[model samples]
Target: MQLPLPPSPMALPLSGRFPAPFLPPSMRKAGLLHPIASASLSPTIKDETIDWVEATSNFFEKDTRPIMLFDGVCNLCNGGVRFVRANDRNRRIRLEALQSDAGKKLLRRSGRAPDDISSVVLVEKDRSYIKSEAVLRIMEYLELPFPQLALFLQFVPLFVRNIVYDNIADNRYTLFGRSESCEI
Candidate 1:
């Protein structure tokens, strides 16, 4: 007989409250999370508590370049990734599709649900950034004008920036279309 899958540790509790902020037991045991600064850093699971910053640090090895995780099937996201790859002469940033195994793992390791692909995720320097911040950070690695433009845009308030970002993100599939499969 086929065996049933175990319930996910991330499932909502019986009380109907939101799930706790902690790595799923499977993830915690798999050692997917690595501390950037110390070899001895380990999660304390007392009462299922977790140190989010420590848990999310250095998901990829320190030697690897910054990773930009995008929606694989979204045309706009794919285009954005291609543009970054073409413009990043030094290859300072690495791109991963949210549909990829590595991307899903990184997302989970960063305390986000793997299926929550609404925002682009930028993981760099032992930290994860999302939405407008992630886009702005990615610009820093692109050639000319973009870095300067990103710096200038940073002067805008975060709420206002995110409002624009969220509108684009929410309607990207309708605007730029989507691929039947991941483009790259």
Candidate 2:
């Protein structure tokens, strides 16, 4: 039996596949051509701000660069970390397994559940981004196509982006398999 598909940004043309800004104004306004919401027409960085006040108040005790805190035991999370490590030539993207002391501190500071392996966290001095926003923002550290792709995905709303992230996260262990530790 064919299972019903989940409602996704893919349903909104010029969104899931190609970058929306690439579409001509004529195509975008056509509505028939681009099924995206009008609000998405304008640039909006839909990053969720996590409160790190309590966590970083004194424990961290210093201005830290952007840190990518991930599920140390999740294979999928490890693979992503490796990919970023390789592509992030400058090493601007720092990684910390949520299973680590530093990672736990950052998560608690950001008011995130340390056990929530389903969501990845990107912590910066000013703010933190979780879930899909973390993934896309991390892409900016890479050269070429990755940042470009992130630019396109940024236009899509967080709710729309989360659908895909949540689906994969829900079945990550089953699909990519899991390990006891994703430490690098």
RMSD of each: 12.6, 12.9
Q: Which 10-residue window of candidate 1 scores lowest in summed lDDT?
A: 10-19
lDDT of 1 by residue, 31-138 (tens): 544233123332332223544444545544465687889999999998898899889999889888988987876665554666779989887655567888889989
TM-score of predicted model 1?
Answer: 0.68
> Where does model 2 exceed 4 Å of error?
1-63
In order of appearance, the predictions have TM-scores of 0.68, 0.66
* Residue 74, model 1: Cα distance from true site in angstroms: 0.3
Worst ten-residue run, lDDT, model 2?
Answer: 9-18
**Candidate 2: tens digits of C-alpha lDDT, residues 54-82:** 53555335635578988888888889988
Clashing pairs in 2: 55-109, 72-182
